[model samples]
Target: MYVAVKGGERAIDNAHAWLAEERRGDLAVPELTTAQIREQMTLAVNRVMAEGSLYDPDLAALAIKQARGDLIEAIFLIRAYRTTLPRFGSSLPVDTGAMACDRRISATFKDLPGGQVLGPTFDYTHRLLDFMLAADGDVPAAPEMPVDPAPVPHVMSFLNSEGLIAQETCDGTPAPDLTRAPLELPAARALRLQALTRGDEGFVLGMAYSTQRGYARNHAFVGELRIGTVPVEMEIPELGISIEIGEITLTECETVNQFTGSKTEPAQFTRGYGLVFGQTERKAISMALVDRALRWEELGEDDQGAPAQDAEFVLYHCDNIQATGFLEHIKLPHYVDFQSELELVRKLRRDATGQGAE
Candidate 1:
């Protein structure tokens, strides 16, 4: 057996020190504070929390600063830290119907019950460079008005009222935890969504966009995109009731996709759903599209061999953490395997020469 290179320990330590120096850039510049990162680089923090499957903005901000704004590295930091945290208990699913929305809009409906609240979106902004931001320019503050607490009901409810979509069924089966369990083939809705929520943003976005471009195009319309905090609760088995545990900010995107109904059932609109931590409507929307495409099998539609329609394909490639780790691990020593291939080639050459001589 070929021996491997030594000094991985010392090399790792030295690399870490170099990384720290690289992250700092210069000793002359003042260090960025955690609070500053959290406040100023909020979008980065939102991404880390969304991808890391954690809800702590503060921790995500710290991780981003430490990683020097390398989002993958920030995600790694958050994932590592999240693994260290204890799972005290599982909270009951948040009642998303009662979301106190900061931003609520529907592409399908021009007007809805709670009128759209376009809170803090860059949708209208030009893609050109904003040179003024380099010097911290400020815009005039708009009038601040408090939103009503009565809750904004969904636009899809109107369709549901007419029995156009499948009515939501509540079966008491406990959902599988992706983090704790290894992902298996043919994932259920809970498993697929869990993977999608923490999945790579860019990858999911591309897959989502592909649907629009006709890769398993289900003719999706954004049914709703809502961002808000929902109360988390836990069932007290002893007390026979659920108590409020805490709250988590979430972005939920529900898409209404066209479905040509099966022989057994009448034609009805199907749903594509995406829910992720933080105010990430883009990721949520992307996720919803992919989710709908993957449901071809369950909905009894033809797969058409599309990437988005393949459950195994989408679930496996969605997360960059896993993808990157596996892809990069190859950088480590593989001399033994290389030597084996070298020997095989050399032996083949020798045999060919010997046969020519004979």
Candidate 2:
């Protein structure tokens, strides 16, 4: 190879200029409005919000437009911006069980206490692209509707009564924030789920898929999937009562997996859990499967040395931001280390050829 060139500054400047131009197509075309993107490209906004761990739809939409529709890059941008903003205080954890659900379904039961509402899902939509979207379009606005604030009942409440699944008990310990701190080993389920929710959707999906393909096959059934805007409240010790601070969209999935009985107990069902920001069913579902697989040791199942069963394997590899940062950091500059390796190779080859000649 031609001796490496070292004009990184110039290369970066040119690349950035090209990216900027690409992001804003022809100057003639009116720039994409943020409102247009937010309303029309909602799925993209949802993914960004979910991965970025911030729920500002307008900002997410702006990030998507600036990234030129690259969802992961948009997420990265939002996350970077999110880190810079000042934090006031943490809201008391939202009681998702009490969420005013927009959509709810229970695979475990055909008739739950609250009837399942299949609201705004593409699961039944045909895969064909809509012609109306490309042309400046107007679909009739959904009717003016008044919705009552009905509480959603959990699907697992019935199972809990019978003690079929492992009981979930929280001692009310506040979960650690990974953004402000580095991840430590032997993480709790809350920390694990936090990492998975903001994790790369595709990466987590693959890890979950591997579990089902007999890698660490834990027979899992979709116990429930729910999507809705849940009210976040804070109990102001000064004020003495919890008040709703804001609301955020959430996708929650719980998977019921097969469990082996302990010596004193009969066989029972274990659990895999997933929860993420925004209406992201796929990511949430995947998180649940992988979450369940990681619980093998706790559930009295042998650690069959599967990838999903390995806590270290799943938690660390699931984040695209971390993976991409480390992967791309090498592209920045390692000339000092590379030159040392090059010299070593040259010296070894020279000595080997000289010895052969002798």
Candidate 3:
């Protein structure tokens, strides 16, 4: 006999206890530290930070540990934690031109000012599995080169100088905060970039792939892709001075896309841009593609009705936290709804049988 439970408090408590025990699998095995995840599983930590819109590595690592290595859950934890933090002051935008670049490459030009520094990329690596890595691998140290302190000019600037590319204008207009406000349609570039940077990696990748497969195909050429550290500065209100607070690693991608000339303007190349926290080149490049696709309206391109071009559709569905919550909620108790549906089906069958006999 099935006994109906009245209150769910005890059941919920017991379930949480069981989950905690399951999260810590074996008693004999050594526990994984947050530092280990931060250092060893760096990519996972980067994903959590990017999606959570928080730059704290320690907190992101702790979230990963608490969530049992589930990246989406980790992001949720970080996001929830970030909301509790008090706002102090906004930092001035860090200039990427002054970045201490570790890796810089340009697909459009053969020779650049930085001379194509390919620092620590998996581009040329073979996809073979290393047996040593499976069993506490001892890796040799990589050769080091002194980081150049010179400012590397952007590749797009070269094109802009030649008057072959369209120039972007910024009149110091403040960007809208997607986190603070409800998403309105016809989003600006800043808001779109914000959504893309924190959007689900897999979802953004799929949308970019769709654009590449002739679904709003924009001939995207990698103008420049860079990964490096840049200084963050904040203005002191009391002292009237701007001081460097810290430095953070960032990845920036600029994609040059094909352009069509209007009656008022000449034919010039346009650009798609992506900037994200940490060394996330794949996400950066994919973001650039999706960004370009979304800009079809502004650029006077015809609406192809592609998934990537649909801003509302992409932004709404790209959030893993919301999607996971709605999906997982389906597993909750639905006994009453199921019983009602069962009764309706039984009555419908009986009525059909009676009509057939008549």
Candidate 4:
């Protein structure tokens, strides 16, 4: 049982004042602005937005600033603020195929339609730390390429055309919103995807790594990975027409797994898909592998009892906010509960020793 403690109002107020002072650390140093965090710390802002399930970069940056760069805290602030906002209409599904890709690549094919375009990525860069950046030296602008007008075709489309890949079909059912309703098991693929996209990156990455390291191994290959901006559209009920709201950057990954076939059916390649906000390639790729692993039952593959294959385990623990809240609560006043436990232990010990309850 938990009990509330009183008579610490003065201490609590002092602690709050101290926290505020520490948050504004180093009076001599220039104060950081939300705009600076939004622009310079773009990746951090993106993470806050992604995990917080909000797309407002400005608000995310502000939260980051208030949280003093503690990302999970920033996410908590954003989520709390998001709860207070009024609901708006949902947007139409984004067309990633029509994305103005910043980076596009295929590992399966050497030369496919819409040739490889490596945008701003750190993949090929050496791990050496540049001292020049520390000195805040001026950097030259990177050369620009002419934008291609044609729509970029999905890499899986080629496989689909050849009847090599298992085709995905939609039943025209509206996808369930986990935000509105509590997560119910056995979740649909759409709901799983929703959870995965907003899941803690480190947790998802570790689960995905487990699959690659021979736990329910699915021989996976990245068919294509792309990052770009896609327009968001929402249909107005009064106007009865769809209008473009805005564009948001996204990273998309499609992984082709080893073929599965029955005696009567031809061997066909299976697939895993991941799409996430911003240029979070690692998170997106990890999401795909875990997604595929979780589909073991539906894909007719053996479960092998992998953690990633356990939907309840993955879905329940993937949320960092929930995990952190439970963890951090232990630091709060548990004195009454501890005292009860302490009394029980002492009584048990005394009983074992044949001592009186004096």
Candidate 5:
């Protein structure tokens, strides 16, 4: 006989109440403000904004606080909130060439225009935790250096001029939005890039690492990695002029991959591109590598049956929210299902022992 439990509604209510209390932690300790999280836990807020496809830092911080620092849950909350907002006219494509770059680096060139700017990177920092951060301490601002005012040219543009890399052709067609339509087979490059940008960071990082570990090796070189603020503009139909709407921080990565051309084409270097919201360099670079790995068919290269090479596998499994929902749903009521299997097993055992009694 199977037993069923009731009073799930009350139990759920009490659990939520307890969770709210736990979220606040000790009553004696000061409650963390949203501004504090926005400024101090900037990377977390940035990740939430990037994955959620929203750009409001304050709202992202609030979501983080409400989620108790669960980044995916914060992203989910932001996504849910975004669905309720009214739509505005789309802005013109941002001119990244005019970007006021704070961090600009090119791994392919030793020296270039605007030079290499190692701005606000954790790359050189020691992994040791600073104990001073635990206690309240007055922090002094670091001295600033004069930044190059001239626009920095893209590294890939130089290669393109020399006819050494694949040419980026523009068809002027509006890319399909995956949010509005169902995902179809043979996704376009734009759609694939959008998915990779919003996909789980850890999952994308693993896929990119797998490619580097001889699974569809593309011999990728970091052509450039730039992080900075770019002005957003919207063309006013009434005024017939474009004006700056606002500014947003972004991270862009371009990978140069070795291409041995097929019989139909000549050998040249190829490119993989990634642009993401906020200063998420790791995510952007990983996204670019994975993007290139998925382009094997378009590049006329043979698929090595690698995990990164499987577009369907990467797209389907990259969503953290969907994966979490399915995994957590196992805890739901399944007594009837297990009872059926139990009866079947008992019946089979009884039949084997020559006992036909029910």
Candidate 6:
């Protein structure tokens, strides 16, 4: 119950002015450009793009700048701006197998088809902070290898051919658009994937960690993880042909879990899939774990009463925008509601003490 307070127009205006001044910071220091955020703060920009459900790096960089590095606020700005854009026709599904991979590795097999290409990763880097970067260090360029034109096959394909892993099949059913439609319960795998892809990274990571901590553990192993650029194509109505629209970098993860078998079906390894915009491997891996956890019913496994296994709970709370909106609204003025509660408590105390009404 919010009561309108109409006397703070000037205060609100001045507050906004102060916010703008603070966003600019000290005038002596060189102002950070959006390009710097896009390049230097690449991880932050990628996170914004992934959770905001928009892939425009420039807009994401600008939002980060405008929000003063508050990533959630930047995501809020992106989501709000996304609503106002006109809807173009949907593009065809990208072919991950045809991706021009920068990084590709397999935990299941070291000697896979494409071999391991550790393009750019922090896996081998020491975590010590370098003061040289603070003093504007000039880094030497990384050595480059000639681009491979051969198509990189998916690691899961090998297991599939050997009938060791569960095979995924498409029923030709169109996937639901969670943006246009409100999220409904008993969501299909496609809808859940949509929500998880744009879901809060922290929340998803926590949930996935819980699984590894023995809550609904599926004995998961990373089959393959790849980060690469894939071409996006859209069909033209007039021409009746698909044309390449653009390319976007993505991180894809495929996890193999414990085998499931029944009296009717042979035991085959289960799979968990994750795909996210940009090079967000952590989020992608987390998404895969949670995705598998939610599939307990589909996999004919007993529910372990875990938070990750509860679809309603996971889907409802995973959205950072919705969670933040509800949580932040309590900070708004609630004087009238508070006063009413105060009076009620006072009257109750007075009655308990046998005092006359005042």
Candidate 1 residue runs with Cα over 4 Å from true position: 1-4, 237-241, 350-358
The C-alpha stretches of model 4 lying farther than 4 A from their native spots are none
Evaluated at residue 150, the lDDT of candidate 6 is: 74
* lDDT tens per residue, model 6, 27-59: 999999999999989889999999999999999
For candidate 4, the per-residue lDDT at 297 reads 86
Which residue segments of model 3 deviate by more than 4 Å?
1-7, 355-358
Q: Indicate which candidate wins on TM-score.
A: 6
Better of 1 and 4 by lDDT: 4
Model 2, residue 356: distance off in Å is 8.2
Report the C-alpha displacement of residue 2, candidate 3, in angstroms.
Answer: 19
Candidate 2 deviates by what RMSD? 2.8
lDDT of 5 by residue, 247-350 (tens): 99999999999998878788899988889999999999999999999999988889899999999999888877778788887887889989899999989999
TM-score of each: 0.93, 0.91, 0.94, 0.96, 0.95, 0.97
Predicted model with the maximum lDDT = 6
Give the CA lDDT, 0 to 100, for residue 124 in model 4. Answer: 97
Report lDDT (Cα) of residue 219, candidate 4.
Answer: 73
Per-residue lDDT of 1-358 in model 1, one digit per residue for the tens? 4455687789889999998899888899899999999887777788899888788989999899888888998899999898999998887778998888888989988888979888878998888998788777896788888878778888889999998986666587887888888899878888898999999999999998888899897689999999988888899999999988788888999999897778788889989998988878889999999989988887888878888888888889988899999899888788989989999998889898895355
- lDDT tens digits by residue: candidate 2, 104-194: 8878789877787778888789999998978958887877655657786788778888989878789899888987888888998888888
Deviating ranges (above 4 Å) for candidate 6: 356-358
Which pairs clash in the backbone of model 1? Answer: none
* Candidate 6, position 94, lDDT: 96
What tens-digit string does per-residue lDDT give for candidate 3 at 1-358? Answer: 2234677789889989998998888989899899999998888898899999999889999999999999999999999998899888899999999988989999999999878999888899998898999897899898877777897999999999999988888778999987778677788888899999999999999999899899997789999999999999999999999999999999999999999789888999999999988889999999999999999988888998888899999988888888899899777777888888899998889888895354
Tell how far residue 81 is off in model 6, in angstroms: 0.6
335: Cα error in model 2, Å: 3.7
If the candidates were sorted by their TM-score against the true structure, best first, what order would they fall in? 6, 4, 5, 3, 1, 2
* Superposed Cα deviation of residue 152, candidate 3 (Å): 1.0
